[model samples]
Target: MMFDKVIAAVDKKLERFDPIWQAENGVGGQRDRYYDKTGVAKWREWRGVKDTMVDYGAWLKNLASMAMMVASAPIPCLKGFWEYRWMGSYLGTFMFIDRLFEGFRGYELVTAHKCMHAIVRSLTKKIAFCLSNDRRLGGGKDTDRIVPMDEVLPPLFMMGFKELVPFPLQTLPEFIICDVDQHIEPYYIDVAESFGLPADVCSRCAAETGVALDDAFPLIGKAMISTNMPCNASEATSMFQRRRIGMPDFPVTLAMIHNEPGAHPYSTQMLKDAIAFVEKEYGVKYDWDNLFKYAKLMNEQNTIELEKWDYFKTPYSALCGIAETLYRLYAWASVNGTDPYFNKVDRQVIKIMRKAYEEKKEPFGGRTRHRAFLWGPSAVYYTDFPTWIQNCWGINIVLNMDSTMGHNMINTEDPDEAIKDLALFSEKATMRHHAVGGWDNVNAIWEWAKNFNCDMVLMNDNIACKGMLGVHALMEEQARDLGFHFIFIEHDLEDCRTVSRQDMRNCVNGYMSVVLGEEPLDPTLVEFDDSDAY
Candidate 1:
């Protein structure tokens, strides 16, 4: 009782330091809650009594998910922790969840937590299964049943092999962990460079190469399916992976410059060949019935997703910022219509979004001053940039480059027609469709911005990406010609050590304060050191 009373008094004192409270009382500093140079908050954010309970409940759910993962495979989980460097970084998952939705409340908070918990539950199960079956950890029965593939390759078609698991090899070791802990990727990036791989290559590719060289990727599959996708940089990384993995491998090189009508046939045939290779290696049949079932689920998710976009154009969208983007990135890329749970989540989210729109309930209590269309791959380390912008400045990111991936509907009845439809969809995967598909695809940002009714563009400039380097001048000139406020936030993709989080924040701070001549809604967030933050 005494402890609770003390905490309440401290929280009340801290409330006066909050900008909203300061506006009324005229006392205290908001940034006092944190120790200098670190993200360790001295106290939890006080969001009144009700919202704090809701936030705490969601945090507990995530903790339970992690506990269940370890309980399901205790020995293997322990072995994984001992064997893998990346396992230690997953401890920051709770902190990552807390930081991502820092200022959120009400329906937006509920929606964000629901979407995030689904990801957490799914990823935890995946980690447990991968660790149990990992040959490096004394291979369980399902080891041969796992089919390791490039993380960028859409796993929807792999559902046709009913008996096998389609595992994204790099996700466990490198991709997802980088988002949780910024410090994790640099070690791998350094490993790649020290191995005589050039330092100028894309950090994403370099990190994967480093993972391969360090032998961190789990040995879980009979054969590996590699791809020349997202970009040419991945081709070399895939090669390094194949060599280190030492498995029978199939190269699925889909068409680049894929906007033309002629590209579908080539990409479609490649998908077929990939299927044939898998069948031959695994001694499994391509079950058309199985693939069709997932296709219908995929179709439903895409249909609902399109409906959600209509609400995004209005002021009443309950889902905006990082909650919308991060969920879509994982659901569309990682789950890809194969999981029934995501389809369920999609249906539930859309219903909430529709009700919010009908009631005219706006996100962030309608504080949005500008609607921006975010283009290019976002910095994985600073994944909550969208959330920070809306809290500090009133910029609502209506859409991100990754969220716009692969929405085409798949035909369920016919095999021949379905593969072709899938080709059209797969070609649009993440960076493959927009960043490197061609100049026409790259230039189509104007049309997208217009459709979404965005007044500004916050373009990500990943310094090491060779493909996007040449388009800077053209994009800047076009932004001016089209009469839009534009800013380039620069970072080295996954490597936070190179650009640092503060540098990225200053990009917006300078633009908002100097260029637009605007003051921050929360001055506490305008400039703080999260350089030591997880």
Candidate 2:
């Protein structure tokens, strides 16, 4: 009876496990090696080879007989044994399929499977705990313990894990959290650390099991805080500094005002126009004195009275003013050969807003949301405006519509599309323009870098995406040849928590160094000293 129940469950799962669903869920596709015929053949070949090395046929036969006996046993006497045995069988079959698929594709299947296993184990453990405690699980308390929908599912999926997991498992939060906290996080951390980060950096990695376990075992929030603290400060400071110096100066700083609330475009063409104007007005040569004068005048003209416009309406105009002011400062720096401090200006902006938001200060106005502007000599030469004035001020920059490599490509099914997309994005999105794609091959990437004169290349290594590893390696090699710096960051774009603030900072710092031709300030210098706190 026990064996019959287990088989029945497996049969049901198999019948319900749609190939279309698997394809939609990221377990099938061109990138998934297991789905391909060649990969399947290879796995079968491997299985045959492995079978010759051991008496696996006999072992399986004996196990099958025992399973049958257990399944047919009296229901009351075999309930516990059947449940345990059947669950193992279910998982073992699932893993076998996963491994076979991975072996055929020439990709490591361990990461995804480990994640699945973790989730399964976690759920089982939690159910066992709840059963032991004689407590009903539901409502807000259950919601609090539930793994975030994003955390349990792969990013490639359109839906959340809550929508994908077996209905029986959805009630078990501890199980999902445990699997991720135990299995998946460690794998990611291990891969990240293998890149030769310093011991201190490794220790600070939030995904480290030792750190996670410390939080899990004790039910302590403080352990969680300590694990994440190091990277946060490092990252924030790095991004702040990168924007300060790496941004170049241009003539006509134009920005698009997002009509929608809280929807700021990370890149805009209006700013590009301002940059172009600065370039033509000042000439190819850096003319500090005149540039500053022009910027000051522009700022004065753009400034508006607080009473005239809504707060949102004011941000665009204020952004224009800030851009003008920054240009003036950049001009001053050119002649003096000294760094212009942006921290003071930034602090002032913060101060003005703090009063408006917190203090309920009178006349809540004069606030702006302009973070930074892009500028460089490249903007000037790239323009093709007929009129000298129009050419100088033309901000015909195109925004990158698709940032992902797979999404950006015209022929995503073909591996060579990676090379094509990279070249197209770079060429189309030069200077004021922006495009996104990753490298397909080393030679293709090298060619693009040389042609476009890229100063830096950033790569994200997702351990789950086995198809991208070779391309990543090629990108690193191409970076060396093209005389550009390469910076690799580990991140799950879908799961923001996977990337700490410090990781972002380090990446930004590396990019700044490449763009500015200078070393960034050390994270340690900016770190607040808390040792003396009571």
Candidate 3:
């Protein structure tokens, strides 16, 4: 009971300081904005709902959310206190952390599940990526087959499997968006280095290579599905793993379009064969009717997405586009195809935007000075850049490559036809649409920008994806040719060491000030200092 005089003295001093913050107008509490008696009851109601969830993990998630919500209550009343005005950034960080760790506590994580096929580690990276991410991004219930760039995967479900996972990778959008890859991947990269992986190989691939080489990713799923899209990192992983890590052999079904005449049919047959492979291997039965069910749902989602994209095209939101763009990339192609979440969110989005469209309102609320579109991969490494731009110098990213909803409509008139249609539809997903070389290759970028009324092109060069890097100059020239300014920054979508976050900010700020002729709020970021340490 004998407390030190020093403690007593500090406690008295602390109470005096605390009163200032707790003085009704202080940062001590924001309960007035978030809760009245009714609101408190509402929170309890949600707490009760969470109590009914079958999974214990829901409890942890709910508690975390509750903490975040409470922590954010002051945000609405931020103007009441100058010190609390930057609540958006703090709340944003919490949301980012929550999104990053969504499924880790729920199911036997996608990375931990067991699979029974010979996965070319190259192809399986997409599989592994989607499996781990499907639950969080798409609201997808299960992972049945790994389908790349196809809205037509209900066929596999029809065969008997519960869920079919789709890979929309040209760049790993999910991992990049999560940015937690930076935490888990560095160790894996070290493992790859120890295993004698090449230095010049893209860090994205190299990091995934680290995952396989260390046997860190749990081998799960019935079979591996991939397309012949030249993802060098995946190839490097597969080729190198064969020489080293000795991953369990699994059957790989490579879905490709060798002939334009029979391409649809070929994709359909390949998918059907893949269904057979999984049924034979995983012992899961496929339900043919699910094909039509998912097909209808996906079609509905596509329409909603188009409507949402129309809202995006308008200047309405003051939000930094990068974080929003990342979520859209996850939601639009991947999750929208899987569940009703996207449609529900789209309805809310449309509601908010309808007023804007009708009133002829600017989405950025006059904050946007530059209307930009992202090229190549996004800067997942410095995801805050978009927000920084918004806070520092109001730039609106009107469109992200992943957010493009072009040509995703699939015919559900016939499920069999839907199979081919959706399979091919998925083939045209974000990175795949442009990454797969042909007439539309780089030209597609121009075509998309022409529609969006973009003011400038912000290319986030993921140094890891060299294929796109090879044509960097051509795309930049095209952007200029379109009479729009082009600014390219060399930054990885995943790894941070290549270009530190502040430097990435500096590069973007420099471009904004110099090339775009916009004054930056933090002009210090516009300078280039090569001597700076990563």
Candidate 2 Cα misplacement greater than 4 A, ranges: 1-456, 462-465, 480-485, 490-516, 519-534
Which of 1 and 3 is ahead in TM-score? 1
**Candidate 2 residue-wise lDDT, 74-128, digit = tens:** 3421332233212222223322323222211101111112222323333344333
lDDT, candidate 2, equals: 0.26
Task: Summarize candidate 3's per-residue lDDT along 144-204 as a digit string, tens digits.
Answer: 3443332212222332245554443322322432242333445556678787876667665
Winner by lDDT: 1
How accurate locally, in lDDT, is each candidate?
A: 0.86, 0.26, 0.47
Q: Which stretches of candidate 3 lie over 4 Å from their true place?
A: 1-160, 163-178, 226-230, 238-263, 317-320, 332-336, 376-378, 405-407, 522-534
Candidates sorted by TM-score, descending order?
1, 3, 2
lDDT, residue 182, candidate 3: 35
lDDT of 3 at 86: 17
Q: TM-score winner among the candidates?
A: 1
How many residue-pair clashes does candidate 3 contain?
27
State the TM-score for model 1.
Answer: 0.95
As for lDDT, the candidate ahead, 1 or 2, is: 1
